[model samples]
Target chain A: MDKLNEILLNYADVDEIPDSASFRKDLGLSSFDTACLITEIRTVMGISLEPADFIKCKTVGALKDYLNTK
Target chain B: MIEKILPDGSKVTAFPISIPQQFMFFMSAQYGAKYPVNNIGLCCFIHGGADLEILRDALYEAISRCDTMRLRFTPDEKYKILQYITPETEMNIDIIDMSDIPLEEAKLKLQSISREDIPTYNCEIHKISLIRFKGNTDGIFMRLHHFAMDAYSTGVFLRDASEIYLHKTKGTAYPKPMRPYLPVLLQELQYINSPQQTEDKDYWFRSLSEADEPVFTDYMLDNRLTQQQKKNPSQRFADIHSGSPEAGTLIFSMSEDESKRILSVCEEKQLSVCAFLSMGLRTALSVFNNNETDVSFKMIVNRRGTVAEKKSGGIRINYFPMRSIIPGDMKFADAVNEISLIQNDIYGHCSLSFWDMLIERHKSMPSDAKPDSTYDSIGLSYQPPTEHIQLGSSPDEVIWFNNGASMIPLYLTIKHRTTDGGFDFIFEYRKDPDPVYDLNIFFTKLRGALLAGAEDPDITAHVLLKQLKITDEERKGKNNG
Candidate 1:
């Protein structure tokens, strides 16, 4: 979560990104930014993810669930 | 007789158009006879009930405010000059009843209408129509030639028209008239004849003389040679100036999240969005051309805000060539930064007209060598965020489409939509037999390359090229031959 917060910081204010916040609708992460976040997640959390997966998991909590499954 | 009252309460019979307008008029006369070139069209869909009479009056009022809408082109020996006329000439908004037609059929009809050509040269270059659909939905189609207005002017017209419509509907006072095009036109004329133009001419001549030959031409030549050797070659050839060419558009968008990330990257790198996108395009093209070191393409720059031409309401756009050389081992971030610097330098001198550049290039070309007419094969335009206007109860949907014939083979317009904070990528390309490049595949790879670069900014461009595995399939035949 802290790592996710760090990556999100590049795009939005730290306070803006919450567990329930949607990356696209709420945070307005562009396609390139989402790609960067996906790469960062793989590098930091050691979880390989696809852009489609991130798109599907719109919120941080959903993303965590997907990561747990992975 | 309709009269235009000057600032000092004097009447003027005729006025000259701006330099850009004159340029467009001449170019259209030379090239736009077969198809309507440089025509901009907008379709605004209004929902709920709105008075048609009030809407008509509002449109007329909008036209009355801007001299550009009331302009007609007069041909001279050398150039077709523009003259503003009075509204006494009949300018009726064509109202079509689409309520009786099926929705699909109505849409098909609308598409056909959009393809229809308007008066191109030495004529009135603006028209408006209203289409009434079933269930309280109405659509307004406004078409303006590039000589009269640009993309920015379209927004301004819509905003003012809507404001006037709202006021008229409520029986309120009309809004103030917009800044006329005469002042802007005069300003542009002064700049065109100034010493700065001479300096610009010199700068362009030096730049083009020093620049490398376009890489796409080489790619096409290689492809053509390969095709000639094939036993079952495709019947179609790659011709830049093929008559009866078909224009097609491919649109893609970046998600809000992805847009935000790119913005963050740009902000951190001190690069403009346009520069960042251009780098991505350069990198992608390099990979596509089998790791070509240098990629060159023309880019359209709007000179409306420049010191020479500060007024914003008319056509002030010109195309200039941009080249980026990529080292095989350079990191993606470094490549982007380097390209950004090059872009800044090119943009600083973008005020130089493309026509002037061509004339300069033509002078230096050897008598035996063919004149280079291939620069227009590809172009990139980055449209900044435009002011959004609301027409009565906020439109349920707004559709903007370009109806003009494409002057280039492949033109990419990257528009940043402020309402949604998203990017709209429009790729308008000409149809050719045996296309030099597969546009769909190219766009997909472009998106992938940009995403990959964003993910691992430290990765060298060479590695990205390897991943993409772009090769000269067209060159394969030539090698065999």
Candidate 2:
């Protein structure tokens, strides 16, 4: 229901994304998928972020915390 | 292995062409690649109007995101043909204002250009123009080579562009970039000699290993084959070894209400629209051949099952003969189910190389056998329109353009009209005299047979075709000699 999860739903096929799940290994999120997520996060969440911001966040929890900090 | 510098100074590194691209080249080779046989054009007429600047920016972004649209090809070598996406080379889209001319005349001008080849060797393989076709009735016309894009990919590209335009105007979500096509192409290219290839080959070869060859039933039913038969009594079947590539289209549309009625009937009978359509076509051919049961035609399968294949923009069309046998006593509804079962089996192994199967069948044929003479005179496809609406354009305003050539005698495409979800039966056929008259008769008979069968599922195909027989009134009225 959250903005991040809502956008992630569009890209990731899996239903539940645990905070500890690996973005690349578990969800199989390719770099292109990550780029789309960044765009969606900006447009849907109305937050601007960089690719490096994604680098700092490994799992779902880290990405959520980083976005919330903004 | 070849490197060249594009005009944009981008180093063009070539990758091997995919199987679909190889099929395209094989067809194009017939005309020395001079004819625009591989062209797919779309002209979307925006209802109110579209800003050229915004649409142009949107087109730019769309093309940039969908890498296949930026493809360029090298001339075919005996062993290797290559294509590359020039990173810096951009599509030169012109905003042509034909507002002063009548819409029909403006369309003729654009269509003339579409018929010409895009100079595939060391050149950009697509072209586009933003046209102002009188007042606020403007549209974008795009010409793409089939080597790089298929009908499905065109829809993806158009939907992407429109979504980008909406984002610029209404502040909607920024569109997602398309998945890169190269990965999809690489995966498919590996299908050539893989273990899966051998399994698929076995599936197809065994499925079509019937003792008897499917008799080619000419849909033209114009008696050209009948005449040929009178001349060559020993000939196995229709000798449509020769046909012109110059094409014309005859479109029959079912209104939204009528389409809904038929769709409801199909749903109630638990029959797919495609199966219902195939039954009508094959039945008509069967009746024309004196209730001869066996009928076959090429069915084009657009291979896009996964998210990766769905989002990737490139041609993934595989075509193979679909043969069906309908006895005279078979009920129309039952026939539809029979065809559906066959379709399911075909779709299960539709990824197998069509050329390989053709070779296996024809390798031992007589030396004089023209490849075209062996199987089908018709190819068929059904496209469902599911693209979400955008661009502030009315659905009726969207127009799809034919690339002005076809190798097949007739290619029938039944697609849901995006505007009203109606069915448009577009018959793309070569320009030959007998075809026009024959198709005129065939379309009327097929349409009636389809609707009546849908309305009454219990009607036997024999009864349905008997009713749909070319009325004497039709024969007397406009049966052009």
Candidate 3:
């Protein structure tokens, strides 16, 4: 599975991720949750981001690509 | 009636104490009224489903049980409860058609109730207004006497009424009040002359003495209404301009990737998300004020840890003013680390009252340190999301009451896990009496500063502003050129 699918399956409770599944709206992720997640991904995938960097990453797929580079 | 425990230790029912004493002795001897001391009530937005008759019935029931609701008091020491007063309670109910009434109209209607001319002990009840929308609903507005209750206590009363309504609708047994109002008043008076009274007085004296000269923030905004001025209810809601410069809640959403990044940062810094953000806020606010010497803000300790206190719950909070005094030569990270040290000591020495500390210091100082108002603003840890309790339905969609009173300049409320990784803040200010639009400007600068710091941990206020390009173009050109 790709990083995005892996994140969804491992962390989220839902089956079959929808296109509209926003980190805040669908996953019930708060600002803190987003921060922790970004920090974890940075360590797990060897990438780094600024605290406000998540403000730019809106979705799972989008986040996966951003992480792929760093 | 004064519950006097005499010299022999026997008690006597003495004559009523004066109204001010009633305020001083019964409620907290401290001015418990929300400052800008108008009518005492806060957040008085009414909801639909409230019938005028039902609300009236609740008020009548409350008045019938607590006759002091109608009894007016003179401020004199003779402690006279005057009998010749007119109806001390007043109410206004406006039936606002749902579609025609906008949110600002509703908010303005609620904001218009004033307490400038009200007697210290008399009741002021604005009529419950009705606003009808697609759903079958109504709204109520209230301006109760501050002497009678605080906002938290009033919320309890409203909750009781709501429960009563639900019970009556479903034909359930109506619960009785735990104790009568007058009996409670009498019980409270017993402590007035007790040995603990000295401690209480010392507490007040300390609080006043510690705050040498109160700092007032002037938010520039006009909120005064002309004698003949009419409110255009159709316009946008008027903002409460604060005269005080203060910082409030900072809210923003983060993405999954961003969340992970924040966690890594927290791990690297060995700080919770809240602590990290708080450090950032401290750094930013400290830099913005150009006061690189010291930055101070209060940290709230929620004492609701034990179950017994939770059962007969009262707001048991003691504020610790955490001060970060940076050395003349130190980096931002070093300043934050020092702030963390202050927080540790604050939590350790938290036993002493900030009020008492002031009193101890005041004993050595000369008089004339008192101010009309104290500290301009307070910093609060936000109400936790897990503990968020909605009393009933959210406030109804329409509001209309007609005494325009102003709130104190800067009242701040914050919610977040200080030990963990989340923070949200809310700031309330008086839009009308403000001389500078400080709150808005503060929030704007804060967001800029925090984000700038987040990008680079070593970022200073000057660097942050330079990064954001907030400096004058000419200055920038000169520096660049």
For model 1, how does the per-residue alpha-carbon lDDT over B95-210 read when each residue is reduced to its tens digit? 88898877567666666666667774445568788888877778777777777788767766776787788787775556545665666666666776688788878877877666
Clashing residue pairs in candidate 1 (N, C-alpha, C atoms within 3 angstroms): A28-B256, A28-B257, A29-B256, A29-B257, A29-B258, A30-B257, A30-B258, A30-B259, A30-B260, A31-B258
* Order of models, best lDDT first: 2, 1, 3
Better model by lDDT, 1 or 2? 2
Q: State which docking tier applies to candidate 2.
A: incorrect
Quote fnat for model 2.
0.00
Candidate 2 segments whose C-alpha is farther than 4 A from its true place: A1-70, B1-13, B76-78, B231-234, B363-368, B476-480
| Residue-level lDDT tens digits of model 2 in B143-169 | 888888988888888888888998998
RMSD, each candidate, Å? 12.4, 10.3, 15.6
How would you encode candidate 1's per-residue C-alpha lDDT over A26-51 as one tens digit per residue? 76544334544665678878888865
Candidate ranking under TM-score, highest first, comes to 2, 1, 3
**For every model shown, what is its TM-score relative to the native structure?**
0.72, 0.83, 0.47
Interface RMSD of each: 13.9, 14.4, 12.0
